[model samples]
Target: MTTLRLGFARGGLEIKQFLRSRESVVFTLFFPLLLLVIFGSVFDAEIAPGVSFTQYFAAGIIAAGLLTTGFQSLAIQIPMEREKGILKRLRGTPMPRTAYFIGKVIMVLAIGAAETVVLVATAAAFYDLPVPSTAAKWVTFGWVSLLGISACTLCGIAFSSLARTGRGAPAIVTPVALVLQFISGVFFQYTSIPEWMRTIASLFPLKWITQGMRSVFLPDSFAAQEVGGGWQLGYVAIALGAWVIIGLALCVFTFRWTDRG
Candidate 1:
């Protein structure tokens, strides 16, 4: 109980710090809204002759927010903390070191969940999209959203070890994330994309997350063309488990408590 409280307090502090950053808010919240505006407008006219652009855009934006909050933010911030001696300072406390990580996980999950809700609500209200009508689909959305955040958080921590400075962190994380988004079928339709690109997207978690989100909201006809046979639960499990193992291994091997180089 004490350790959990410690973890929650630590997580709360980090969340407060993160919320104070204008750049962070811009990317985390406004960027999705920006995409929602531009792409949502472009695809407004009965995309695929019956499909709702609002529904499709909602899923893509949610996936994008997850990546931004879970993966990109961690990749940028962890190395900064290391360089600033925050990790080193924390190590001297009586608190369990895992508590810090646990806090971060909790914080990011909350942020991701909030982003999902905001995007969904916005879509439903102004964009004319309805929430998932079936209980099964809502359940699927919940699982997929959780899995998406988990996978990205793990991958982010793993990648953070590679960055040496905060300055280079955004440069390193953003371009790769953008490339993944492009190929991930978030900004583009999967059917219109070439077969080679589809194969590439299938190899990444971002694609799976977007596909999973679409499965929850879109019809079966739309879902079938996505990779992994329409959000197969097995694939989400496999991808998440693999990333978790890799992240844990990297954290054990290279994650440092001190800024000392």
Candidate 2:
């Protein structure tokens, strides 16, 4: 109980600090909106028979925002904290290690929520994205968002173990993330990609995340555009669940207390 409270306080501080940072505000908040506006403007027509390209891409943009906020942000921030001796100093203190990580997870979840609202609003306003209009659609969005935030946050923590210094964090993280995004159909039409590429992408969470969002926003007829001709909500849940399990194991066994190595 005491340790949880410590984490609660610590998480609040982290969130406030992150919110105040100008760079974070731009990247976390505005970057997705910009992308949505730019690409959505260029591709204005329906990609499929009834679904506009803007609608098709908007879901991907929202997922991109959530991914950037949780996975990419933490992948960089953790190493920077280590470089600054923040993690090392915290480690030397009596603070519970779990409290520190819990603090990070709290901060990421808060950011993820805020990013979702902002991205969804922008997409609806600019791209005419079919908002979740029914109870089932909203329910799907709710679960997908919850699982997505969890998966990305855990992946971020586990991947942070790879960073040895703050200076090179983005170089290491961004390329891998971008590659995954491209392959996962976040920045392009999913079916347009080759079958082999789609096969490779199936192993990752972002593809399933995009599919989950499409399920909620696109019409039921849009399912024809999907890989299996349906939403595949079960696969989304299972894939993200697998990632959460993998992340938990990696964080426990391989997480670096400090970026000394």
lDDT of 2 by residue, 49-128 (tens): 88998888888878777688778998999988888989989999999998998899899888888888988888887678
The weakest ten consecutive residues by lDDT in model 1 span 222-231
TM-score for each predicted model, relative to the true structure: 0.91, 0.97
lDDT of 1 at 60: 79
Clashing pairs in 2: none
How big is the positional error of residue 224 in model 2, measured in Å on the Cα after superposition?
1.2
TM-score of 2: 0.97
What's every prediction's RMSD, in angstroms?
A: 2.0, 1.2
Against the true structure, whose TM-score is highest? Answer: 2
Q: Which TM-score value belongs to model 1? A: 0.91
lDDT, residue 104, candidate 1: 90
Q: Model 1's lDDT to the true fold?
A: 0.80
The alpha-carbon deviation from the true structure for residue 82 of candidate 2, after best TM-score superposition, in angstroms, is 1.0
